[model samples]
Target chain A: MIEIVNLHKSFGKNQVLRGATLKVEKGESMVVIGGSGSGKSVLIKHIIGFLKPDEGSVMIDSVDIANLSENERYETRKRFGMLFQMAALFDSMKVWENVAFALIRHGKLKDKEAKEIAVEKLRAVGLVGVEDLMPSELSGGMKKRVGLARAIAHSPEILLYDEPTTGLDPIMADAINDLIIEMKKRLSVTSVAITHDMHSAYKIADRIAMLYEGRIVQTGTPDEIRNTDNAIVRQFITGSAVGPIKIEGVTA
Target chain B: MIRLIELIGRFVEILWSTLMSFARELGKILLLLCATMKQLILPPFELKNTFKQIIEVGIKSLPVVVITAVFTGMVLALQSYTGFKRFNAEVLVGTVVALSITRELGPVLTGLIVAGRAGAAMAAELGTMRVTEQIDALETLATNPVKYLIVPRFIAGVIMLPSLTIVADFVGIIGGYFVGVTVLGANSSVYWKRTWDYLEITDIYNGLIKACFFGASIAIISCYKGFYTEGGAEGVGKATTGAVVLSSMTILISDYFLSAWLFK
Candidate 1:
C-alpha cells in the first residue's frame, strides 16, 4: 500500500502542492484526476522519490520513503515502474532495449534473456517486430505502448503512470485505458495513474481521487465521484467553464 | 535623496541575489563532482562508455587542436624571431617557441578546442535528455544517472585531455620548427638544438597536468549545466552555449593560476 499524508511542496512561490493526501490500497488501480498543474505529477514524483515533500510523509509499504537515504530510495525504487507523460523512452536505445532497461539493469537478467522478455511484452502490448527500431520511429500510440511494455516488463509491485493517454485520439486513449486495466488484472500491480481524462478515470479506476488547486478535494469510487453533490466535483466532471472554480485572472 | 536611497537599496538587493545564485550553483556543481568521484571509484565501471567519450573528446578533437597548435606555433616563431633579431638573439627563437608551446599554449588551446566540441555536445545531449525526461526514466529504472551518464565522461576527460595536449605540444613544436627552419631561413640544426636543450620534461608535465584539470572542469560543468536544464528547447540551447562559454572561461582563468602554482 502507498499512503501520502499532508504533503506540502512549493517551487519558489508557485506552491504546487499543499496538504495533499491520498492512498492506494494493495492491488488496486487508483486514478488521480486533476487539471493541468494541479500537483498530480508532484504527488507522484514525491512517491517515486523524485521530489521530497516539505511537510508530510509518503509511506510505501509502511516506510516513510520521503526520509529514506539516497541508497535506500534507490533500493525502494527497484520495485517501481513509471511510465512518463511523454513515454520518455531513451532515444539512445532501441525499442527493445528501452523495454528491457529495468530488467537488465536491476533484475540482473542477461541481455539475451531480457530481449526475449522484451519481445514478449511488446507483443502483449500489441506491438510486434519493432524491437530494432528507435523511439523516434514510433508514433504516439506506439510509443505509449512501448512505454507500457517497459513499465510492466519487470513485473514491478507498483506502477505509476503520468498522463498516459494525454496526446492520443479518443480510440487510442480508450485502447490505452483498456490496456491499463488489463495490465493491472494480469500483473496484480498496485497502480496510481494521474490523468485529466475523465473517461479514462471512469474506465481504469477502482477509486477516483480529484486534486483541486493543491489538496485532494475528493476520493471515492468512480460512481460516487460522478454523482457527487459537491459543486467543485460537479463542475470538473461536467467540463463546464462556469462554476465556483475560477480561472483566476481570466474573465469568462 | 529618498529616490536615490531606494535605487541604491534595489541595486544592492539585486547584486546580493546574483552573487548568492552564483554561489548556490557553484555548490551544486561541487556536489555533483563529489558524487561523480564516488561513483567512479565503485565497481562496475563503464569501460565502453569511457572509451566512447575518449574518442568523442580526444580523437574527434584532433583536427581542431592540430590547427590551433600549428597556427599558434607559427605565430610564436615569427613573433619571437622579430623580437630576438634586434637584440641579436635569433638563436633563442626555438627556445622561446618550445617553452611557450609546452608550458602554456598547448594545454590551453587544446582545452578550449575540446570545450567547444565535447563540452558543448555533452551539455546539449544531456539537456535534451532532461527535457525529454530520459534522465528521470533512468532514475525510475533504479540507475543512478551520476554513475551511468557522468562518471564515464569525467573519466574520459581526465584521461584524454593530457593525451590531446601531448599531441598539441608535439605538433606545435614541429610547427615552430617548420617556421623557423623552412620559412625564416634559420639554421635547422641550431634551431632543433636550442629547442631540445631548453625544453625540460617538467614543462611538458606541468602543461599535461593543467590539461587534466581543464578536461575534468569542462566535463563536470557541462554535465552540471545539462543535468539541471529546464524550459525545453530554448533551455537546451542556453545550456549548450553556457557550457562552452563557462568551460572556456574556466580553462583560460585556471590556466593562469595553474601556471603560477606549477611554475612558481
Candidate 2:
C-alpha cells in the first residue's frame, strides 16, 4: 500500500498542499480529481520524491520515502513507474530504447535481452511493429501508449499517472482507460492518477478523492463521489461553473 | 548629472543582485558538479549516451566552425597585408597571421560559432524540455539531470573545443597562406617558412587552453540558463539568447585574464 500522511508543501507564501492525507491499498486504483491549480500534480511530485514535503511523510510499502537519500530514492524508484502528461518520451531515443531505458541505465539486462524485453513491453501496450520509430513519429495516443509501455517495462509495483487522458480524444481516452484497467487487473499494481478528467476517474478509479484549496475535500468510492452534495466536487465533476470554482483563469 | 547618478545607482543595484544570484546558482552548480563526477566514476556510466552527445555537439558542429574560421582567416590576412606593407614587413605577414589566430582568433571565433550553433541549441532543447516538464519526468524516473544532461555536454565541450580550435587554427593558417600567395602576390615559401618559424607549441597550447575555458564557460552558462527556464516559448527564446550573449561576454572577459597569466 502507498500512504500520504499529513503532507504539507509550500512554494514561498503560496501553500500548495496542507495536511493532505490519502491512501491506496495494494491492487487499488485511486484517482485524484481537482480543478486546475488544485495541487494534484504537486502532491504526485511529493509522492515521487521529486519535491519534498514541507512536513509529514509519504510512505510507500510502509517505508517513509520522503526522508530517503538520493541513492535510496533511486532504489525506491525501482518499484515505481509513471506516465507523464506530455508522455515525456525521450525524443533522442527510439521507441524500443525508450521502453528499455531503465533496463539499460541500471545494467539489469544486456542489449539483446533489453531489446527483447522492450519489444515485449511494446507488444503489451499494443505497439509491436513501431519499435524503430521515434517519439516525434508517434501520434499523441501512440506516444501515451509508448509512455505506458516504458513505465511498466520494469514491472513496477506502483504506477502513477499525471493527467494521462488530458490530450486524447474521447475514444482514445476511453482506450487508455481500458488499457489502465487491463494493466491494473493483470499486474495487481497500486495506481494513483492525478487528473481533472472525471471520465477517466470514473473509468479507472476504485476510489476517488477530490483535492481543493490544497487539501483533499472528499474521499470515497466512485458512486459516493457522484452522489456527494459537496458543491466543489459537484462543480468539478459535472463541468458546471455555477458554484465555487472561479472562471476568470479557467475555461470550463 | 542627476540622471547619470540615478542611472549609475540602478546599474550598481542590478550588478549587486546579479552577483548575489550568481553566487547562489554557482553554489548549486558546484554541488551538481560533485554529483555528476560521482556518477561518472561509478559503474554503468552511460558511455553510449555520452558518445552520442559528443557526436551531437562536437562532430555535428564542424561545418559552421570551419566556414567561420576560414572567412575570419581570409579577412585577417587581407586587412593585415595592407598595414604590414606600409612598414615593408609584408613577408612577416605569415608570422603575424599564425600568431594572432593561435592566441586569440581561433578560440574566439570557435566559441562564437559554437555559441550560435551548439550553445543556443543546447539552451533551447533543454529549455523546451524544462517548460514541457520532461526534466521533472527524468527526476521522477530517478535519472539525475546534471549527470545525464549537463556533465556529458560539459565534458564534451572541454574535450572538443581544443580539437575544434586545432581545426580552425589549421584552416585559418592555410587560408592566410592562400590569400598571401594568390591574392596578395607574396612568395609561398616565404609565407610558409615565416609561419613555421613564428609559431611554436606554446602558442598552440595557449589557444587550446583558452578554448578549454571558453567551451566550459559556454556549456555552463547555456546549461544553467536552459535548466532553469520557466514560463513558455518566450522564456525559452530569451534564455537561449541570454546564454549565447553571456557566454560570449564571459569568454572575452576571461580571455583577458587568461592572456595576462599566460604572457606573465
Tell me, by TM-score, which candidate is best: 1
Worst 10 residues of 1 chain B by lDDT: B43-52
lDDT of 1 by residue, A40-146 (tens): 99999998999988899899999999778888999998899999999999998999999999888777799999999999999999999999999999999999999
Specify the poorest-scoring 10-residue window by lDDT in model 1 chain A.
A243-252
Considering only N, C-alpha and C atoms within 3 Å, which residue pairs clash in candidate 2? none
Model 2 over residues A1-252: C-alpha lDDT tens digits? Answer: 989998899999999899999988999999999988889999998878888889989999899987788789988887889999989988877999888988877756888899999999988888769999989999999999999998998888999999999999999999999999999998989999999998899989999999998888999999999999998899889999688877656565
Error of 1 at B27 (Å): 1.2
User: How well is each residue in B93-183 modelled by candidate 1, as lDDT tens digits?
Assistant: 9999999999999999999999999999999999999999999999998889999899989988999899999999999999999999999
- Taken over the whole model, the C-alpha lDDT of each candidate is 0.93, 0.88
Residue-level lDDT of model 2, residues B72-182, one tens digit each, is 788889989999889898988899889988989999889888877888988998899899787876776668887788878787788888889999999999888889899
In angstroms, the error of model 2 at A237 is 2.4
Q: How many residue pairs clash in each candidate?
A: 0, 0
Query: Top model by lDDT, which number?
Result: 1
